[model samples]
Target: MKPMRSIILVVLLTLGLFMLSSCTRTDAPSESHSIAPSQSTDNTNDTPSATARISFVSAGNEAGFYSVEEYDGHGIVAYIDYATQTQLPLCGRPECRHSDSSCTAYALVENMSIPVLAVINDKLVIMQTEVGSDTLPHISIADLDGSNPQLLCELDSNISISPQLYTDGANLYALATVYSGSGSHLELYRFSLKDGSYESLCSFADGVNGMITSCFDMSLTLMFTRIDEESGSVEDYAQVFHVDTNTLDDPVISLTGVSEEAYTIYNSTLITLDTKDALTATMTFTDLRTGSSVEYKTNALLSASGMNSATLNVFDLWDGWYRITLNGDGKFASFNVNPVTGEFFPMTLYYEDSMNVVLIFAESGNNLLVRAGWDETRDGTTLTNLKPIYALISKDDYLHSVPNYTYIEGLDL
Candidate 1:
């Protein structure tokens, strides 16, 4: 199957939008620099904090099973079998790597390999694909140990599935793309994990790049960007509306000229990536309830780590900073972009060959957690099997060598 993020086509937004055509000129190479870790000016001197439990998926010996291992910077602290849907009895031994090929956690799932998308409420939300079939992309929820797998819903193979999925206590949410003769549209769906059912929450003709649903005026409101599919576009704007009502009649806020795909609403402020050209997108911030907005520019916003493809907003905010990962181009690097200053801070840990390194979770001012795969491949492009790996980078040593790692030999499927 195709890489999931490419189908969304958010970051690869072309060079003809008004944001691109109106640019003063292309940026010179001097403005772009490979930021090394030791050069970070942001408090990289603080003492490294104690290691804590962080969640990651481990490849199992069985065809369809992956172990959800909780590592404490040293060894497995806790683990759940991803395929059997059963939690392995806590291995009585400490410092147990749990790498034994015969470990009880290994189980089979009819020879079908799935990628764990989200671990919610002790269950695994996985991306399901069929062998030799490229069109049957769907999501399934299985017990944390990988048992009782249930198909939640089938997805449009044409639309890309956002790797960043969300859950609010009871429902699972996702953003996807839909293309037809009329053009492309951004759509949202909510699956009721409890009932194995889902609903078409909404769609945006302006094309959605990123989205967040939060309580506004005591009700849930969805906030996102409305971007034009092409240059000379008229639909580019920042918008939000109540989830219970039709957005067609909702009043449009005053925010303007924003790419819908590169934004997030944080603490009542709408942060968006605004660019007239592909090379110099400005990270714009606007107050949703007020009529004020702020903008910051950076070259890093245009491309990401691996294939130098495009940037995908991971929807994480750290102490007034936003996190984004480079997707598409098979490049691997994460950036902590300040929405207020338009400055980009590239993480030090680099992934050779693959753009699979992502900042999955983080603890501000302490440690940044990342989920990645480590294999013999220096570049991730041609490897059919990758060994899953996880690491913790120190805040003081974001560019320092990875001080800790947990590696499991398995196919990265």
Candidate 2:
């Protein structure tokens, strides 16, 4: 009886090992769908466990060409080539009008396989996390094409519970949510990319949840939302903090207001979107350095019935243009807002399907990198089929002529 019991246990262990192996295979699809990059020739494009935080960077060797990361979220992070429609470099929307033929799509990092959080300074920042594991995620750096992998640092266990890493120029910052028997709070820390040394910059007490939204124009900003147990409702208010990159400790300016829909920092000005009602909204531009602010109110935001339930959020701020996205009901749309004048203009996108999913990646002058997706007409909350596609669109074409007037065909995601 003892020998029989031992044999049964052995067989079960063997079966478990095989199941785990099957689940860990690379996600790259068939060769027909995969683009094999020069540096990464391997096929491993599994769907990302999370969304990829991507940024655009120059390939250095190629003139007028740039690259961005395409990740399945957990397994594969690759660099893909991006170029203007013409052979020469065009920066502005008026100049870089790429049709299907003008822009080229090629793989840059396909052979490599890893999950990364950011692409900065021509390098990939990888984060390794495990479930219920006491060990903190080990951070590693890799080349733009997923080459030359190097370990940066293992974050402190106390601060790495749920860490969000960000970089500005050469410095790295981590925003982590830490909890204790008393309650949960948020901590902001700075890490040296060169050696991975870190220091706690500030802490927000009673912060149940928070996010480090933007680090631009030599400033870092964080948003925090606290919950009240007695009310059994999230507080209508939120806290926003701003600090200069050079001076992280000395003085931190705080702003309190209604929870923000979206925010961006440009030229030291922090612009926030605050929706008032169905037909109206306010955009507040506060100078992070000076604390001076100017608010612009618009009535064209809400629907006619005044029953609009859509949520308006600030997507990305580039140059002088701020991308504001509206999502609700069944459709989504993106508008480019001029922060100085409070002018809103629509960027007409040719929706392949009407599921209303849109993502604005980056902007070069007037050209916007956009990814649009849709799920088969919803049967309540369940979608039958899902489709995502990527493209480059010029703001001028949509503003001057007609929305959806010009569309660039490229990779299908």
Candidate 3:
């Protein structure tokens, strides 16, 4: 199957909609120099309180099922049995086919709004925006078993939340496009799940609606792309913004990089790999907490094959880990990487291969969920995948290169 992010971006940018996009794909290396925040005059020695990284899980809860979205807008509840390598709809009602609005396995899809799945504080949360029939977009809460859905709240019809959501279990952080008589602005919205009070934390680039390059508890790094509505062409903005997630005040730093795809922010540090070529490049690591930046020369740590392919990308992972994915034409390779001192290795554990587009879907507890897409037949251009199956391998096994994994079979019927 094709990369999920690419497909979404193509559709949004294609229609010239100033909607929020997600890196929800790229990664970084290490650097040194005089780095700075835009609004702050603080020197390199000034360091704010260091916050721990936030753990983000997929819509798939710990209860063994994933709520996957279909093209028709409803989210299909797939109950997966890892040991048996099988999956089926989670609807428990007898004699019920997993289709139509009445099916319990299908999430709420009213007025042409797609249901987005998220597990917040052990409660299955489904957020939907009714863009067609009504302006009221509501969030619904369900049990871990995918039953007893109750109305949580209806959002402002004008503000649309992006699918990329980050939560600390108590507070949820979302990027939404706020529409008004003026135009649309991408604002980061923070919601208090307890009392249901919400506030707009910060607004990103004025017309800038793009992707989350990296996300943390106290900070979120974002990259916006300039898309021409007339031509439908997308260009990556030169500056990437790292926004503060703590306060309502506007405090952001812009890191000018060679390519947005090569940037990654973690542990209050920003990394950029300026590639001279597939084999040669320069890496920079900037500690935003200190305002100090460093640069170093580097080269590709993997094999020579497919090094020149244009599908190269870097993505920040849980903790200090980073992922380097190189996919193009018929070649695909993923690696566990570190730009400091050039330590890198291929992702040989899980479903690592050149035959299919293997993806790290999300993190679940102590294990990382991995999957590849499939279809009865693929459209040559879009490469759409019909069935999605996933499995889990211990995070320790993944980072350590141990090949133990449990697979789930995606039912064709």
Candidate 4:
């Protein structure tokens, strides 16, 4: 009986030892393991499915107007819907005097839309006009939806002509001509949308010719060609002026021997073409704040003639480059320019008659809204009608567009 009891005790001791060994192994791992307090707390709340929120707005058309022609020999403003390939009429009755025999016929010969459309603080300001006498040249200012097209202002009676209208974020600038005994002389004016006031900035005695053109803002400055009327030649001279919207002063400074049909400004740099050979002569970047200038010459990507009939517009794409559009031959071609190197490369090519193109930049230029024209497919080359194309190029090289939002991102909204 003593031996049997001893055996049972031994067996019990072995079982206890086995259980103790297992418990020891488990406790050793817990003691050796060291988890940081922060990590342990984070593990309690950290979600494995966390992600960032993103949304996008469709791009609006930059080229708002297309073919302005008269149908049946009557003056008509053909507003094309590029996305849908539809046409809308402006005013075609005889009361408007838009007939074939009329001197001011809607020839559609030069259907140039505003080079840039701006949305200032949510107000859609596009440059548009109506068929009327030169004495009463009518301009239109409406919301982005083309509603409330109030007769914002009229051209100066002295000029009796409608020069091309250019707008910055706040003001619209125009170039008009008045006939003097010798000839017609060019004049520049600024129209304030805030107060419906027109202020003359510069007027020269036939020295400056052609339509006055500008990019960005008059505050940034404007570029115009000075011509010698006697020779009917461009003097290879240009003028750059600082328009103080805050004051009514003549802001004209002489920039000699720089004749380019079209140009644009980026980071205070002026990229212009010298019509000498239809090439981009030299890129002159002027720092407005510092009053400093830098010049560089690069190989011509597109010819000056190609740029002329074709709307050549440049926009800075936050990533230290420019997206350029050459809207000629009833087609659209996009190219990218390296701001640092002045190198250009073809980006995208689409068939459309781009009358005008504007870039809408927000957040100091992080995002972009590109608007242009797309004409109706007629003969595989020519666009029978004009329409609009809105392109939104994302920072990640993604592009999106809508049917008729010609201008976006900056206006009043």
Predicted structure with the largest lDDT when compared to the true one:
3
| lDDT leaderboard ranking | 3, 2, 1, 4
Worst 10 residues of 2 by lDDT: 14-23
- Note the Cα lDDT for every prediction shown: 0.40, 0.41, 0.51, 0.37
Q: Please give each candidate's TM-score.
A: 0.48, 0.58, 0.67, 0.47
Best by TM-score: 3
User: Each candidate: RMSD to true structure?
Assistant: 15.2, 15.6, 11.5, 28.9
- Model 2: per-residue Cα lDDT over 1-413, one tens digit each: 01111111111100010110000112211112222222211212221112222112212212112233332221223222334222111111223222322221112222223223444454445554322233455666655334456778775444443333444434556566565677667677665556666667777667456554444443454444445567644432223343342344332323333333444443455555554232466777787667888875545544421435556555344446555556567656556667677677665554654433244443434654444443244678886444334445565653432434223332223
Order the candidates by TM-score, highest first.
Answer: 3, 2, 1, 4
Report the Cα lDDT for residue 181, model 1.
Answer: 73
Clashes of each: 27, 10, 15, 24
Q: Output the lDDT of residue 38, model 4.
A: 12
lDDT of 4: 0.37
Candidate achieving higher TM-score, 2 or 3:
3
Q: Is candidate 1 or candidate 4 better by lDDT?
A: 1
Error of 4 at 390 (Å): 5.3
